[model samples]
Target chain A: MSGEGWVAVVGTGPAGPEWLTPETAGILEQATDLVGYGPYLDRVAAGHQRRHASDNREELARAGHALDLAAEGAKVAVVSGGDPGVFAMGAAVLEAVDRDTAGRWRDVEVTVHPGVSAMQAAAARLGAPLGADFCAISLSDNLKPLAVVERRVRLAAEAGLVMALYNPASRARPWQLGRVLEVLGEVHPPQTPVIFATAAGRGDQERLTVTTLAEADPARADMRTLVLVGIPATRVLQRPDGTLRVYTPRYYEEAE
Target chain B: MSGEGWVAVVGTGPAGPEWLTPETAGILEQATDLVGYGPYLDRVAAGHQRRHASDNREELARAGHALDLAAEGAKVAVVSGGDPGVFAMGAAVLEAVDRDTAGRWRDVEVTVHPGVSAMQAAAARLGAPLGADFCAISLSDNLKPLAVVERRVRLAAEAGLVMALYNPASRARPWQLGRVLEVLGEVHPPQTPVIFATAAGRGDQERLTVTTLAEADPARADMRTLVLVGIPATRVLQRPDGTLRVYTPRYYEEAE
Candidate 1:
């Protein structure tokens, strides 16, 4: 093959297919091969496309494989949960392409398709915790040093930006989130709102936990959870029916 | 009309209707009243829904009106461009609810549906400039002080976070983006990549400008543009076809 094929790195969004953009859905339908982690691949219904499943830890290898397939004239779709550009397969594939010393995939075209990210879906579920200035940091130290994560978390907290933490905790790195919480508590008030959203937009599996920094438990978060820590201005409102909503106001109160 | 109605704040994404999520599309279809800024409301087609268009500066009024309609048994969709939860109408509506001192709208239920944000769309277009830890700061100072914006911009830059600047410039606030650029230039090297993407995901109107900190001009951006400034680790690669892609590596090299 003359590398006539192309690769589309697509995000299926979070939860269900209903959150998928029409553009992404159409691209999924036209792909010759679908490549992604097993669970994310499960979101897309099996069709005429060939499925390529891999473990999440093997992002580089999977990206290379997708590139190889595309170079061989196969239209490959690298599926990612949430927006592919945000700590997902989009960068991994781009990294692979950058490291292709021989330029074997030089002629293969690559494109990125955006989707509703996990933080976005989670924020939507909880009203608008990320309505103003915000920063997203993945607490998992699998790729970067824990120190770098800690430094970034502290700076984001100090800046008073609403913080959305991805991969908050997992079996492999349980203590990282606790340490992050410690860093956040040092800068924000004890009453600052903390929200833990699991499987948001995923139907019945969706669960939202709202608490304050003084009472937030890191143990409540896992790999599937997205944790949002609010700035001092973040507010929690209670509806008439007892449901709760959290959002940061757009206008910041510069000290009276 | 016993205040039994509900409000759904829906994001139509950046440009076209194709970027609309199925869930948001369904909400738009079911809403009896569609309320938003004139341009954003134009993205949704005419239907049985009553349209209420307002000026861009009237976000709070538009939100209050939507709430009022919903309280009157109208299934209202408050439309926003890109993810409503991100520097959009989501916070405005929630602010309106928060200020309902008399609790007149207590019975009204509100929900948010996330969509691809402008920064995410722009990142996708540029091949993942936000691949790692990132922060979004709105450069418009209409609601906040310039000193605050500058401080946050400085903190985000010093922390080495990829920065996405929303509302980079407008006719009334043209100098704010220039000030932000000056702050960024102080912290980052001259070679830092600065991208100004306007109308991303919108067909013919979409335009992308890529330059370095030394060459970037604030005049290149407008309110419609989303600007992305890369971290020191950010790299730009040129493909054989003469196109450019920028991405930040997931792993940071700790000081040697």
Candidate 2:
């Protein structure tokens, strides 16, 4: 597909402008219009030559605006932190473009440029917590029913898959992660390795704590937090000086 | 930690030298000794001021050598592709430095700089398969046991977590991922979305077909291939032109 008038869904990496991949930066620089949650657009350095539509509450509207602009033959960039295809705006963009009124927007090229997710950034800091089979689920029931979230948590725990919890808690959903733990407790032991990482890669980044499922306190978590729960085989080794690291034992390595 | 004889663990991003994060590049430029797997060393285009230890095998040996050099006051940079800490030699360096023979190296400072992981690279090209709660498991049983692999696979599948399968198959371990599919079939449906991504960032990069669990052929997979399996909640939407895109339902946004 020709690249002109395309909608580029770009992942800006974890934090800061430097983490943005070259491909993402190039799309942002070349786009005629920019659309995203407000904070993400703010992440781009000043003096980029793109018009902006930044609104956190009206995501669908923003996505529609980007698609409308792209349909009008304007190159647009929908910015996301991490990757657009994950939980970000890539799907929303596609949905907006595919709507009956803007069916022609479908012909406009779409490209997704990936960025590092918070789970990865946190895993990178701690060690290879994600080296083995894992699962990522947001504890918030803002959209899905609590029953569904519980079911996924219980099943994932029973499977002994490492779990990355996104949107664990917000002001309105403060007890979400705690509720997830309550469900997970039914299958996973209390000693499961749990790592809570917040604001990973940002200058104001704080809070990298290693604890067990029983010890995890959702009160300390926030929207910025990314919680990682390891399976039964996962272990947290503490150094003599008190630094803790997490690893999932493959067990096969020892068979040799 | 003063930048003096400290070691910095850097990631080379996807492929191009420009893809390297500035912080990672700066660390390489400032280091007095470079230590990493041989293939990774070749990716760094910038010239380093000091010596380097490069090899195809012997990751642990390279870490020991780097730490020994750092003990003698050499500023070291231990490098890896994507991120040093993901599945790379960063942990090996840490383990080696923490050993008793590394008494001098213990006092040496260490910093881990994050980079793009292969999963992220693949997810970027395909939309956001890695954004939701996903598990990444290396199919290679060299350092891990097949039982552990089966357990994790079962758990991840049962939890309805998306999966990024690494080291899916190699010359000697050709049947590993195929066996993993058999384990997954017990829990997951046969029609789950599976993506095979290869050579993510390079010019020759290719993202192959998305098929169902029942139709997946592990024989076609290799060490360089990154396989992504979508969860039950994931939907593969087909465009009017017959193009398919995979996405997971985040539920919360829909409620809003």
Best lDDT among the predictions, by candidate number:
1
Model 2, span A26-68: residue lDDT tens: 7777877777877888887346547575765555677778777
CA error at residue B204 for candidate 1, angstroms: 1.9
For candidate 2, the chain B TM-score comes to 0.89
**Model 1's CAPRI class?**
high
Query: What is the alpha-carbon lDDT for the whole of candidate 2?
Result: 0.70
**Candidate 2 lDDT, B1-256, residue by residue in tens:** 3655766777887677656776677777777777876667778746645547476467667877777777678888888887665667666666655454636666666666678777777776666555455667776546566777788688667656778887787556677788888887777778877888777767766656778789988776766688888776666656655666666655533211
TM accuracy, model 2: 0.88
Q: Tell me each candidate's RMSD, in Å, in order.
A: 1.9, 3.6
What local distance difference test score does each model get?
0.88, 0.70
